[model samples]
Each structure stands twice: as structure tokens, then as C-alpha cells.
Target: MIRVLVVEFTRPDAAAVALGRFLRDEGVEVVHAGPVDTAEQILRTAEQEDPDAVVVLGAEPPSLPGFRVFTTAAEAAEWASGGRSHTADAPSDRAR
Candidate 1:
């Protein structure tokens, strides 16, 4: 099962919520966070979730651990399009 974290603004909620539900139904652990107002908050949340992938459904980009961040749904789609490649990093504000 893939664990996913989401950092979303208003621009990305619809898709984020929908995907979170869909993934959860599929037996994937989806950690959907936000109405995230800041990158720091996202990093903090991701640390706790420790997800395999961090999905940023927002107008801008988010930063995660060993994970990739996306600005829009289409970008996320592309990042996720490659299947295994989607399982990249998690969110983290820490440098170490």
C-alpha cells in the first residue's frame, strides 16, 4: 500500500479530496492535509505521516522528503503517470 500526503490550497481541494477517498477505498493510506496555508505546515504534517509520496494539489508547489511536489493536478498526473515513479518522497522541512 502506498501512503500519500497532500498539501492543498483551494485550487486543489476537489481533486485532492476525491483522490484521497479513491485511494483509501483502494486500500491505500491517503493522508490528506490542508487547506495548507504554508509550506512549513505541510512539511510538519508530512513528517508525521511519513508518506511514500507527497501530492501537492495547489496553485503553487510544496516540498516534501525524498518526495516530489506538484503545482497542479495535471502536473501531479504527469508525475504519477509513471506508476512506480510516483512513489518518490515525503514532505519535510528539515534538511537532515
Candidate 2:
């Protein structure tokens, strides 16, 4: 099974919770790193968890070498499932 470390840096963490649920539904192992204040903290946690990928919700993605950073759970799911074509069910992209 694919393992993912989810880092939520925003306040109101609802998006992260939703992403965790979505990933779990897709059969991915979700590791909640909780809300962090900096990218350094995320990197440190990633080192410990060593997940296949890292998903960041409600914040800009951090730069983690060897692990891909996905802004949306759907995109991460697709990547974890071997780059399958996405459908309309994908959550809307966050506005820039």
C-alpha cells in the first residue's frame, strides 16, 4: 500500500482532514503530521515517516527531495496508483 505523510499548515485544518479521508478511501495509508509552522518541520517529519509522497493542503508545498509534493489528494492518489488518468471527481484546484 502507498504511504503518504499529510502536512497541514493552515488554520481551520478542514481541508487536510478531507484529504486524509479521501486518501484513506482510495486505500492509501495516511499519516497525519498535524499543523506545522515551517517547511523545516515538515522535512524533519518526512525523514522519520519516509512516506512515498507528501500531500500539503491549505499551504504551498514544501520542497522534499525524493518525495513528490502534491497540492491535491486526487493528484497524489493518481500518482500513487501509477499515474492513471484523472476524472471529474478530482477536487477543484486551490486558487493562486
lDDT of 1 by residue, 11-94 (tens): 547787777666666566677786877777888887787666677775666545565566555554444444444333632332
lDDT of 1: 0.64
Model 2: lDDT equals 0.72
RMSD of each: 5.4, 9.5
Clashes (N, CA, C under 3 Å) per candidate: 5, 0
> TM-score for every candidate vs. truth?
0.66, 0.72
lDDT (Cα, 0-100) at 53 in candidate 1: 68
Following a full C-alpha superposition, what root-mean-square deviation does model 1 have from the true structure? Answer: 5.4
lDDT of 2 by residue, 29-75 (tens): 78999888888888899888867678887677667776668877667
Task: Write down the worst ten-residue block by lDDT for model 1.
Answer: 87-96
lDDT of each: 0.64, 0.72
What local lDDT score does residue 59 receive in model 2, on the 0 to 100 scale? Answer: 70
